[model samples]
Target: MTDALNDDRKGWMSLLAKAPPARLAALMPDLPDHALLRAPEVGAVMVRGRTGATGAPFNLGEMTVTRCSVRLAEGAVGHAWVQGRDKAHALRAAVVDALMQTPESAGLHACVLAPLAAEAELARAVRAGKAAATKVDFFTMVRGEDA
Candidate 1:
């Protein structure tokens, strides 16, 4: 794939993975002609984390994930792995992924990804506001002897 296509795919995948199931359902477009290359399946994967963002990676724990794969009639294949056991969400995401690789991608990006990205940004802002409300500041007092 070209760099531009890869970048677009990455952006859409991030939005899809973070989007709530209800939100995705509300914006779902008409399904394209496709075949389920791999039916949605729920499984566990080892969640890994890196220390201080640059240290050695370590297994955080096992997380439940649902994954699905689909192949469009035009031969584009798409895959999705989402957190939780929502098979429907995984299937929809995979279908969208496949569609994004086709000529209809521009429409999908505008109708689906744009809205989802906006919603995700709004949700993040709300969370940040809540966190900021409770933020505490620390200071040190100088002793008289220090004069």
Candidate 2:
């Protein structure tokens, strides 16, 4: 795949990872024929973080993650790793990932990815609003000590 296509796939995969499984199932009721290359399984992945935005990376901790891999009948392969122990979420995400690589990708992007992305953005906005509401501004004042 070209760099542009790879980038686009990354965006869709992110949306799938963040999306709720039930919501994705609702959007795509019928999945195309596929074989499970890897059954959904829960595991731990080392979570890493930086002290600040660009600071040195450090191991934050271990997080529970579920992963699955699927291959469509037509040969497109997909894989997914989602946080938590929701096996169904991982499976559904893998299916979507495979579909995103097929010729039906455009239609799926419009019908599925677009809505999921919008919902994710809305959720993010709501969280940001709540955080902003609790934000406190700090300031310091200079006193006329030498006058």
Candidate 3:
């Protein structure tokens, strides 16, 4: 289990934290047919800002966030998310949500969530690499008078 955690660069909670609802739904399998799990609803987007590694402050833009809470017939609750207009992601998030409150979360995190987190990290890394390639540096020199 720890191996899986180390292998995945992105945290499992992070993968679920700002995911697209549709993608999440697609990834997450449905609970037992006899047992129904509630799906999460698309809620308000929360915005936050922070300084980059260089200590320059910037607005990080908004994330479309949805929250879902569900109770399995067996009484387990799971919740999850994706990014942007995504019902599938929301559904899957709810499944994860329901599983989280149970002892089964360890197994679920290892099997289901870890892979998703790893994939997300890979995608993020690719995007970061691409963005980094385009970074521009500007330099200015000050002129000095006679000493």
Q: RMSD to native for every prediction?
A: 2.3, 2.5, 6.8
Models 1 onward score TM values of 0.87, 0.86, 0.57
> Quick one: ranking by lDDT, best first?
2, 1, 3
Report the candidate with higher lDDT, 1 versus 3. Answer: 1
lDDT of 2: 0.91
lDDT of 1 by residue, 46-103 (tens): 9899999799999999999999999998999988999999998998899999988888
Could you give candidate 3's per-residue lDDT for residues 1-147 as a string of tens digits?
A: 376744442355567766544555555656543233445566556565557656765767777766555567777655555556566565566666666656777887787677777777788999999999999887756646632
**What range of 10 consecutive residues in model 3 has the weakest lDDT sum?**
31-40
Query: Model 3 Cα displacement at 137 (Å)?
Result: 7.4
lDDT of all the models against the reference?
0.89, 0.91, 0.62
Residue 78, candidate 2: how far off, in angstroms? 0.9
Q: Provide the lDDT at 42 for model 3.
A: 68
How many residue pairs clash in all the candidates, one count each? 0, 0, 25
User: TM-score: which candidate is best?
Assistant: 1
Q: Return the clash pairs for model 2, or none.
A: none
Better candidate by lDDT, 1 or 2: 2
What's the alpha carbon RMSD for model 1? 2.3
* Best model per lDDT: 2
